[model samples]
Target chain A: MTPLPRWADVVLLPLLNVVLAFLVGGLIVLAVGQNPLQAVGIMLYGAFGYGSGFGYTLYYTTDFIFAGLAVSLAYHAGLFNIGPEGQAYVGGLGVILLGLALNGAHWAIVFPLMIICGGAFGALWAFVPGYLQAKRGSHVVITTILFNFIATSMMGFLISRVLKPVGVNSDESAPLEAITRVPQLRTFIELFKNSPVNLTFFLAIIALFFIYWLIWRTKFGYAVRALGQNPVAANYAGISNQKMIMIVMAMSGVLAAMVAVNNVGGVQGRLILNFVNGAGFVGIAVAFMGRGHPVGVGLSALLFGILYQGGQELAFQMPGITREMIVTIQALVILFTGAMGDMLRAPLARLLARSSSPTGAK
Target chain B: MESYLVDITLILDSTVRLAVPLILACLAGLYSERAGIVDIGLEGKLLAGAFAAASMSAVTGSAWLGLLAGIGAALMFSGIHGLASINFKGNQTISGVALNFLAAGLTTFLGQSWFKRGGYTPQLSGDQRFNPITLPFAEQLREVPILGQIYFELISGHNIITYFAFIAVPVTAWVLFRTRFGLRLRAVGENPKAIDTAGISVTRLRYQALIITAVLVGIGGAYLSIAQSAGFNNNMSAGRGYIALAALIFAKWRPGPALLVCLMFGFLDAVQFRIQGQVFPIIGEVPVQAIQALPYILTVILLAGFIGRAVAPKASGIPYTKER
Candidate 1:
């Protein structure tokens, strides 16, 4: 098979896949007796036409960026960290516990401590599965999935029975003090009015750059890439595959923990049941769609954020279309970009080879 | 003593009911995995089947038609999985995950659009559902002795799907060990290259295996909406597909042991429901979530080889290429 050019592999292929996914999504909208073009218009308008909508889009994008980075880091280490959902859930415990402990502390002090505490907890949660896969030969995919269920059960018990304040009917912790919570961007920027976009959004941007550097520009990154490509070769080169797996998984968990910071610390101001709300799962699609590149992840995360914010508006305005339509589109994106990613490769390679051969002959 | 016996019987009865879907889905996974295709989308298939079955039954008012629709929906999902993994040589796990999300989203999206009842089908009854069937002499034997109560309560009244699930174990064992098709399926899973060398098409065998898997899981899904309950609710499969996957691993891909593991998990579920909010001696109230999480926890332990190693088929999760 002819290899694709780097540009085609990195950018063109992903764009094609996204286009295919949306085309199919449009067909689904048509099947449901709605005008596909109209639906697209509504989605685009909802996502970017107004200031607050764009703010919400960015807020959602922040969560996806962290989650996507988490998956991408582990992917670079040849690990599928499917337990981001679980890790993020457990990470909330850390954020909430610290927030409650320093009830009225300044936001500047509480925010950093919350990140450290939450990242540590999430890393610990992910580290166990990594250790199992590394030492005990358990497959990380299955263990991580089971861990998601366990985390759900454990968190449900804790939130409802242990953490819920007396006389409170809902399963949530006490609200953090206003001064202690991460300040929303709207406080400083007039354009992001009434939006939950916050300091964590900036953290997400920094994390993306940090991941790009850590995955490409460092010795550890070389080892991770080597391990991912071929474990036996990496082992022969004196890189401990076991150690790499555990560390990469922990790093992935730390990235995933940022979702908790975005939601619990930035937006909700309290730990609530199911606060993650499928954002971690959304990360899977984003990571795959991005092809594990920071730039790609950023763009795909923003795309999903648009779909999410827009889909809500679409559901409200268009009675026929529902919010789940976005999930279907996400599924299609994963299908095209991740699972059956190479379905078009043969034809694409042939076409490129045919077209380039004539040009290169000169 | 009598009340305790009655309580035990009731729990066992519910256990049988609950285990039926797990049993079917586990067997479905058994067929697919035995043919070297990892199906993580079993949960999605179950949910799709449930929605299809409920919707079809509501429309046609025929339980049998609902079963067919359920099977058809699962088969469609299996086809997508096959197209991606078998034909396209894509990542099997990713394909499965995609199918699951697709089923979840499409089911609800379509359900709410068509039914307008918040992702639920209309409540089914009468001929639209597979109601419980009382075995011969069950009512007559109710008045007899302790044996009569056991027969009447525990062994007599279940829908056809439950009976089929129990019967499927032996049938699967026979088909796997006694038939040439089964031998080819197992060979395809263990070493597709060898089967390919033996003048048998590995792809055909795998597709066949997947077809059987779809049929079984579809029946399980139908049983959920049409037999066990009245209609399909949102996410009604409720992770039974995953629980079945766990049972499949726990059983180490054997049908007989798969049944036992599913039953054990079902027993845990029944006990969980029974003991919820109930105070017990010494331990006080056992949190329902603990028991709910027990199967997953145990499977993790088993997978980690704390009890024993649960080895999968050699060729599972790898896309087979001619050169490879």
Candidate 2:
């Protein structure tokens, strides 16, 4: 059979899967005796209707973008790194420590330092699992999953026992000094007035470009892709499997950890328990749906950002659509885009092949 | 001395209870993975089972019927995973992860709308839940010292599902070793082509393995909602599935070793539950987080080859094709 066009293979298949997923979500809403059309409209309005709503969407988008990039980069090296959630949690601790230690420092200095510390901590956390997988033959998936739980427990300890404000009686660090907080997008730009969307949104955009170069344009990127495609062949061609594994995992960890900067420095300006939530896990689906491409990751992240913001709005506006409904919608998207992607891709490929064939016959 | 004895009994009792779910899930993974299907969606299956059992029991007021419903829901999910990974040649890991997201999202959404209690099912009551079962003469034997304590508290008083979990370990070992189906299942996992050439259907064997896994995982999940607790709360499985996966690895994917590993992990969980803010001699008030993180740390250590190798089935995670 003739191969489907690159555009169709990369874009069309996922787009169709996404549409079908939303359709299934609509049917689910209908089953619950709600108007699917009305629900969709409400979500759209909630996500994009107002300045704050849009800002929140972008804010969430930044988190997903970082996580999606993290997973996507790891995918390039044939590693399924599910440790981003853990990495981000550890990174938050680094950000919290840096913020507390540098309280009263200029934002110019504190901001960069926070990024560095977050990246370092996240990389450190991921390093052991990567090292184990590469050298000891441990399965990355299980190791990364175990690390997530470890990270959660570690974060709980640090926040409550050591990092807790003297008398707060809560499992959270003290609010960062105002000078250490990054400006919200509204303050930074007049067009985004009254929104919580912050400077990290632009940072995420820059990250998108950087990841694109890292994955597609560089020698290191070529090695990573080669390792992913054929590790034995890559090793034969002079790429060290051990070194690639470590570098890819470290890079993935750094990207995952950067979400701490967005949440800690930009949005909340304080370290709170579970601030990363499930965004890192959601990155797995984002990368899968995006087909491990930067542009695809960016687009899927934006879509998730809308769903998160709009789902909340939908719940508030129409009480029938509960917050959990949004989670179901997200699941449906994951199911279609990741698990059952072939439902669309296979048939579409066959159809495309048939149409493109010279004889137009089987 | 008596207080120490009481504390030991309490922790052991909790370990037995907590280990029930882990044991069942571990056995489920054993069947699926031994058949060459890496069932990472055990967590998703458990959550789905919990939600189904809790909601059904709440509606029908029959814990038995709730169990059936839970198994049914889990089977449907396993079928989806099988079809995707086996038939469609999709990435099994991705499918499993997607199944997890699906279960987490759908159960909460449906639970919220049906019961309107913030994504929790209505609480089960009386006959609607699986009450603890006392073995014959357990209370009469309570005065018999250590033997009495072990019989009554540690072994006898658990819910029926817990007893089944204990029984399941030996039964699984028997099925995997003594039965022809077990031999075929292991062969399919190791080399599907050989199984196919031997006049056996590889797809059928794998599907059957997954179905068994679904049933066992379903029971494990149902036990959590109906027996361990009164009803299902959102995300109630609480990563026990992953811990079971860790236990599976810790046991090197063998059924007999898996039981011990699960119990060990359960003991860690029990410690976590009981050891909060307790002062130890050297550590000086051990953090709850450290206790909670122990199982994962142990898993990392084992996987790092500090212990013997944990090898998977030769053909595990690779989709089988007719030609190759």
Candidate 3:
């Protein structure tokens, strides 16, 4: 089959997939006797209508951007890092420990240390699976899946037994002082009033550009892409596939660790049980929908951010529709964009070819 | 000594009970993976079956009807998986992941909307659940020596599905190794191209394998809600499906070994429950989470070839395409 035009491949195909996902999501709403159009309207208004709502959307978007970039970086290395959830969870330990240790320190001092420590922890968590895959011939997918479960069990123990403050009923660490916590954007900007959007949002934006540069403009990026496309050829070209896999996975873990920085440092101000809350899983859909491109990841992350904030509002407004409807939609997006991605390709290419043949026949 | 014997018996009995769902789902994976389909969505199918069975049993007040509905729900999920992987030639892993999320989201969404109980079906009772059946002379045998107590306490009182789970192992072994269709199915998984060249329909054999997978996994799901817990709760399969998948890998995709691995995992679970908050002779206090995590940790070790190599079917996770 003929390849699709660059524009079609990059933009049109993803847009069609998103549209198909929404159409099916709409059918789900309709199945439950809710008006799909009304649900969409509520979602749009909830996501962007007010200042605080838009702020929440951006807050959620920050998490997705990091998670998406994490998954995308691994995708470029032909690795599926499904343990981002676990990595992020373990990263919370670093963030919390640093925050607690520097409880009276200034936010400016505490924030960067949290990032470094948390990134290190997350990277270490992911590095194990990568190292195993590299040296031991274990498939990263299965090992990563197992790591997620281990993280859950390990984190559950720590939060409940090891870290919980004395006399505290909840399974959480001692909260950081307000001065030491990542300052919310609302403190400086009136538009984001009462929202949790913080400096991490800006960090997320910078990371997106940095990842783009790292993945596309660097020689290491070429090696990674070459490895992904054909490992044997990349090996013949002197790229150590094992070293590349390990480094790329560690980098992906660092990206995933940003979720912890966003949640524990920026919003929660303490380590809590299950705080990642499926954001890492959302990265899988985001990376697939974005086709593993930073620019596309940004757009899809924003789209999911809207769906999340709007879905919350819709659930409150429509008794029939619930928050899980967004999850269903997210699953559909993964299905159409990632799995059955090429189902429409042949027909679309045929149509484009037929339309352009008259002028191109010469 | 008598008290120790009783404790061992009790633990063994719960081990059998806990192993039932894992055994069934592992057998399910055996069939599907043997046909070269990597089904990570087994957890979702189990949850879907649990929800459907609980909802139907609550509404119809018949455990049999609930079982059928549960199987139907799992089959529907398998059909979606088949469509994506077999027909559209999509990424089998991604398709499985999507189906899993779909099952999770749809089950809870519908449960909340339909039952109005925060993603839970109504509590089942009497005919609405598969209650344990006592074997003949179980009461009479309980008063006898160790052998009689073992028969009565350890073997006599489980729901029918538990019995079926044990029975299905030998049946699966026979069906996989002794039948013509079984040979064809294994051939398709090993080398679909060879089967296709020999005039056999690889797709048909795979779909048949998936159908069997759906039935076994559905039964397992139904057993969770109706026999074990008496109703469906959100995410109630609680990673048993994934555990079963791990067991399948641990067994090297063989039916008999799959049963043993599941029982071993189940024993770990029972031991975890028994030892929680308890002190031991050498270990002092054992962390409950450590025991909970043992199965997964072992699976990773096995997969990493630290224990032994686990070689999957050659054609697994690759979609087939006919040569042009």
- Which candidate has the highest DockQ of all? 1
- Give the per-residue lDDT of model 1 (tens digit) for B118-208: 8899999999999889999999999886899999998998999999999999999999999999999899999999999999988888999
RMSD each, Å = 1.1, 1.6, 1.2
List the candidates' TM-scores in order: 0.99, 0.97, 0.98
The fraction of reference A/B contacts recovered in model 3 reads 0.71
The per-residue C-alpha lDDT of model 2 at residue A251 equals: 85
lDDT to native, each model: 0.93, 0.88, 0.93
- Per-residue CA lDDT of model 3 for B204-280, tens digit only, reads 98999999999999999999999999899989988898899999999999999999999999999999999988988
Worst 10 residues of 2 chain B by lDDT: B315-324
Model 1 residue A205 lDDT score: 94
Which runs of model 2 end up more than 4 angstroms from their true locations?
A: A190-194, A356-362
lDDT of 2 by residue, A1-362 (tens): 45668899777988998888889988988998889899878888988998888888998899999999999999989999988999998999888889888988877788888889989999988887889889998988889999999999988888887777787976788888788877787875676676778877888899999989987899999999999999999999999999999888988999999899999887788889999999898788788778788889999899889889988898888777777666666667677777778776667878887667777655
Candidate 1: where is the Cα deviation over 4 Å? none
TM-score preference between candidates 2 and 3, better one: 3
lDDT, candidate 3, residue A44?
Answer: 96
User: On residues B1-324, what C-alpha lDDT tens digit does candidate 2 reach at each position?
Assistant: 978887899899999899999999999999999889998899999999999999999999999999998999899999999998889877788888878888988898888778889888987989888888999999999999888977888878788899899999999999999999999999998999999999888899999999999999999999999999999998999999999998998898899999999999899889987877678898788888888899989889988889787888988888788973
User: Global lDDT for candidate 2?
Assistant: 0.88
Give one digit per residue, the lDDT tens place, for model 1 in A1-362.
Answer: 77999888877888888899889988988887889899888989999989899999999999999999999999988898888989999999999899899989999999999999999989988999999999999998888889989999999999999989999998899999999999999999898898899999999999989999988999999999999999999999999999999999998999998899889988998999989998998999999999999999999999999999999899889988889888899899999999989888888888999999977775
Q: Which docking band does candidate 2 fall into?
A: medium
